[model samples]
Target: MFSLGNVRVRTKLIGGFIIVSLLIGLVGGLGVISLKNVGKKAEGIYSQNLRVVYILTDMQANLERVRGNMAELIYVKDQAQKDELKKSIANDKEENTNYMSEFESINISDEEKKVYEEFQKNITQYRSLRENVIKLVDEGNFEEAEKQYVPIRKVTEPMFISLDKLININVDSAKSANDNIKAINASSNMIMMALSIIGLILAILLGVILSRDINKPLQKIKMFGEKLANYDLNFDFEVTRKDEFGQTGGSLVIAQNNIKELVKTIIENSQSMSAASEELSATVEEISSKAINIDEAVNTIASNMQEASAETEEIGASIEEVDSSVIVLSQKAMEGSNNSNESKVRAKEVKDSSKKAIEESQIIFNEKKNRMLKAIEDEKVVENIKVMAGTIASIAEQTNLLALNAAIEAARAGEQGKGFAVVAEEVRTLAEQSAEAVKNIQETIEEVQKAFKNSIDTGNDILEFINTDVHKQFTEYEKTGNQYYSDADFVSTMSENIAAMSEEITATVGQVSEAMQNMAQNTQKSSEQAEEIRESVNETTQALEHVALTAQNQAELAQKLNEVIQKFNI
Candidate 1:
């Protein structure tokens, strides 16, 4: 039920040509035939019936004239008038003779000819009587003229009868010819009506065929185009030959191929994008892990810094205490110097007590040196951190290998795995970064370990000197009043020095605790970022799944379309 206009123009054009030719030939040929029939009818009527009718009319007119002439001769009285009438009658006789000759030429039936001859004999008799009457009238014989008119009337009467009978036959023949024409007209009318019906039916049939030829293919193509536009490539258009429609079908096939190629390209691109996304996710995860490690390292450094800071603060506080103790010791030394004569033994004992106190201060300084040595043993902790970084680097390298393998697999899978290949590339980049981060962490750990070792060595040297000084101070404590003044000043100076060293150690400890808290906060942030990256990877994976399914469906549809096309034998 599709419109013909919607079909290929070529098909419609061909059909139109056929239809136009049929219509022209039907109408023109039939018209020619009808006209020929009319011509034949005209010929038949004119040749036979019309000719007879005209001849019969002439005979009737001749007979009527002959009767009138005979009557006129009967009325003439004067010799001169009678002579004129006789001459007129002679002329009428001659005209009748010519009419009789024409009637003989028509070749009617023997009976009809005999009737015509009898009428001619009557006319001859009438002419003879008229001639005798005419002669008598010339001789002034009136009675003779009347007798001749009577015989002439009798002779002319039969002529009128013969003419009337022939006229009747001519009328009947004319009527028969008219009836024949009517019959021909009836036949012609019937032919014309039949031809009209035939033409109409032919036109209808042509229209149906033409419409079908044009519209059916077009409707199919239109529906196929709609389906193609909707991305359904499973339809087949079976147009054969090298016509315009066939060319269009070829173009459609090409377009379908292009679409399939495009679909394949899209699948490849999607796979590539998915791969890149996964790689990025892995990189981000690696970065998060590295950040966490860095945070942990920073915490360790911060803890160490805090301890150093606390030690410095404690050193300052100890310096203040040592200054107060030195002030009290100096006061005691001065009081003992001033009260030397009042109690020399007690002064000596007080000097000994002062030396003991100074020795104890040196011992306490040595103990502080031991604590510093313990803190420096944290070098092993830095070494352990370097090992942990090496392990992470190894893991990152393994991840890189896995990504490379995945990329290879993606390439083998062709377009379907292209996205995975991209993701693999991103993963490789992240792995490289993780390895580099591990190297940096290792270097930092080495630097911290070297620094800790140097601090420990310095502390040991100071501790050895302090311990030796403490023993010497104790042994020299009882040596006398001459050296008492020099020893008292020396002991007081050593006590001040001990106090300054103690103050530096306490301040370093408080700084380490503050740094540790900051490190913990940064590690928490890194963990949160890792979780986000994992979620993104999951989404990418889902998208890749959808793309794969779509590609498979498209391939199936293409196969179906191929099968349908085969059915058309195109």
Candidate 2:
């Protein structure tokens, strides 16, 4: 026999419904049977008992009619009146006989049958007396017929009493049958109510029992789902019933075991990853230090180049001053032999100033050359910073990968690894921040490289301008020196040539001054560009420092994540 507990849920539910249906069917069947019995009783009361009562009432009415006609016969004297009375009485008698015959055909009680028999005997005796009165009335013996009326009246009175008795008996039987039907209806109603209450109670109790049996397992399943949602995978699913709940519990146990294995694998892998992250952090730090050193070397080279550019501008200014002195010497030479000594003194001064300017110009040329070499070195440093930016970006990408791996492992560990997941997320975020910082550093380095290139281009333009304009101006000053020396020699012999020489010398001096002003402007622009390059380098260096700091923070977060993941026993 299959126990209810072991049955499938569908079978149990179907069985419960069948039982309730059968109970309701039984109640309905009983009601139908009771109603059928009541119907039969009602048919008996209406068709037999009540029908007999109605027939007895008709008999009584006919008896009264016969009695009335017979009493009228005593007063009736004419032959026609007598014959009318006789016909009326005979019709009344025939109708009463028909009614009595109908009453006798009906089923009646013993007491009613005895009363009906006595009624028949009285009717016979009344009929005999009526016949005699009719015969006396026919003979025109009215007095004798009136004398027979007394005996006839006595016999008819008893017959009427018997007929009334029969009516009363049938009426009583009808009333008794109606009372029985009322009792049966009331009893059936009570029985139906009792059966309905019993059926309802049974249905409710069965429903409750079935519901509890079904819902108990469903509730357990619901609780299990809640536990799973809460990430509590530690509980045992011990249901052993051979039903749906048991099957579900068995599935949950399998899931729990699988989760346990996965978590164990995650813990082992996370431990190994943590060690790798530490090594990566150290490697990044070493790279950062080397980048810092390269930045310092670049800054030193930029500083030296700026100083050399300043000296070249000073030399150009000195050459212009020497040219102005030569114009004064020429003018004094044209003034005459009396101003010859003054011309000689001014001419010697111009020669000395020209020599000094030439020497300074040579020094300026050397400095400018060295500055160009330094600018080339700065360009190399810019390249190095760009390489460092790429390295940092690579390290940041590796860190992001490591963080991703840790987060995946933490997720596999479920509730036990939530703390680690948070830490991994922080590390991942830090890695993203580091990557963004590296990108900023790369952009800043690019800006610095652009500034360096501009500065280098500006320096080259300045060197080219000096090579062209300064060399031309220096050659013109040498020619002016030769003219001044010749003018000194010919001050007595060619005082007329001295005036033209003076005007020419003055114009050459003005040209030298203008050339010097242009050189000064070029130098100033180069200096400003150098300054901008220096600021850009400084910003790039700062950005590198921030990248290093972010890398250090990322390393710390990875360590923390590793430590948290290690705490899980798995």
Candidate 3:
């Protein structure tokens, strides 16, 4: 026989149900058998024995009625009354005969049939005696009629006794049959209850056995799954049964072994990659260092070339400036002779304009100074407002904190503090709103301070510009105007001197231009060499960058491999 443990889970569940069903069927079969026996006994009592008892009672009643009618015939003296009695007696005899026939027709036991035959013989003798008694009465021989009634009367008691005995026998048989039916029914109920209890117990036991058999393997599988989830691959999966759990365990073992081997290979490869990356990193570092050195040397050379180029440009610019000044001086000297009278007239006009301008500038400067002072005062006020806003914000924060403390105290008081908590929450909300308003005010004040500072800085810059550039230019203009007025007579002498200096400046400008040309050619040669070195450095830097990138990629790959390998236990 195959054990339950060896069966598959589906088969085990099915077997459990089948055993429970068999038990139920046994209970049903017993009930059916007992009920069928009760039905047979009930049929015997109701159909045969009880029916015979009812027929016996009817026959006895009819016999008693016939005997009473025959006895009434002897007392009847009137012809009409005697005739009525005789008719009645005849009808009674016919009814008794019919009852006897009915009794004989019924199927009965041999003992009951024998009793019935004796009853029929008694009834027939009584009917014969009753007929003779009626005939004696009809002949007006009342004495003879009375004597005939004696034989009829003698047979009546025996007939009644026989009928009683038959009724008693049938009643006894009915009682025995009813008792058998009751016994059958009682046995059926007891057998059914016992069988039902046994079936229920068997079902429970089978269910427990099947559940244990099923859950034990499942629990082991679940434990194995948990271990696998936790990366613990060291335990043994010892379930080797032929069921699904066994197959699953076998598959898991194979997978675990495979993962172990795979991880080992991955670890080895990751270590190898790590080592190679380190070596490559070192090589890249060396290359990067050398590239940096080359770049520095190239940059130094480029810097020197750039310095030389700048010096050449400055020398050229100086030569151009000198040449332009000489040309201007020569042109001015020629114009001086023609404009000396014009200069004297313009000199007076310039003097008047300079005094007017100085007066206007003084007025403008005073206005600007007063505005700047006001701006400074406003800046101070804005700063004070910013401070006040900060203080208000701090106070709001403190108020919020106090509200929060109050709320906490209220919460600690439980139900009694619910109303207080609501009030505290409202206070906290108001504090938060006040804080927000203060924050907005602070932000506005800060913006105003920044604007004031910017305005102050602009005013200072204006003042500085006026004092440095405008004031100096105006002073020089005024001095020049005064000098021109004073030097009106000496203009021709100055003009002659300026003509002599222009010739000397022209000669110096030619020599400076020639030197500038030589310096430019040398600077061009140096710039070309610097460009070549720079190109070489750039190529080296790119090569080093490529090597570094490759090393970084190798490092990242090694790190990822290590992470993957760490997921399995060896």
Number of the top-ranking candidate, with lDDT as the measure: 3
Candidate 1 displacement at residue 485 in angstroms: 99
Q: What is the C-alpha lDDT profile of model 3 across 1-570, one tens digit per residue?
A: 665555677877777898889988888898888888888888888877777777778777767776777777788677787777667766766776676677677778888888877877887787778778878887889899998898887888989988898988888888888888888888889889988998888888988887787788889989988998888888788865777767777888899898788778878788788788878888888888888988888888888898889889888988888888898888898688447757777887787777777767767777888998998888788788878878887888898898899999999999999999999899889888988988888888888888878887888888777767776777778888888976864785687678778868787887878788788878977887888888888887787788788888888988988886677666
The better-scoring model by TM-score among 2 and 3 is: 3
Q: After superposing candidate 1, which stretches have Cα over 4 Å from the reference?
A: 1-31, 39-59, 94-126, 139-151, 238-247, 262-570
Which 10 residues in a row give candidate 1 its minimum summed lDDT? 561-570
* Winner by lDDT between candidate 3 and candidate 2: 3
Please give the CA lDDT of all the candidate structures: 0.65, 0.76, 0.81
Q: Across residues 1-570, which tens digit of lDDT does each residue of candidate 2 receive?
A: 654556788888888789878878877887898788888888888787778777777777777877788778878767788788878888887887787787667777899888888888887887888889888877878899899988876787777787778767767777887788788788878888897898889889888987887788788888877876665767667775777767877788788778767767765675565566567667656766766776576667657656766776677667666776766676566567446646666776777777677677777877987997898898898789889889988988998999899999999999998999899899889989989998998899889888888887887887777777876777677678767866766765576577677778778777877777776777666666666666666666566567656666666665675665454333
Which residue segments of model 3 deviate by more than 4 Å?
Answer: 1-3, 83-87, 265-561
Task: List, residue by residue over 414-441, the lDDT tens digit for candidate 1.
Answer: 9999999999999999999999999899
TM-score of each: 0.40, 0.45, 0.48
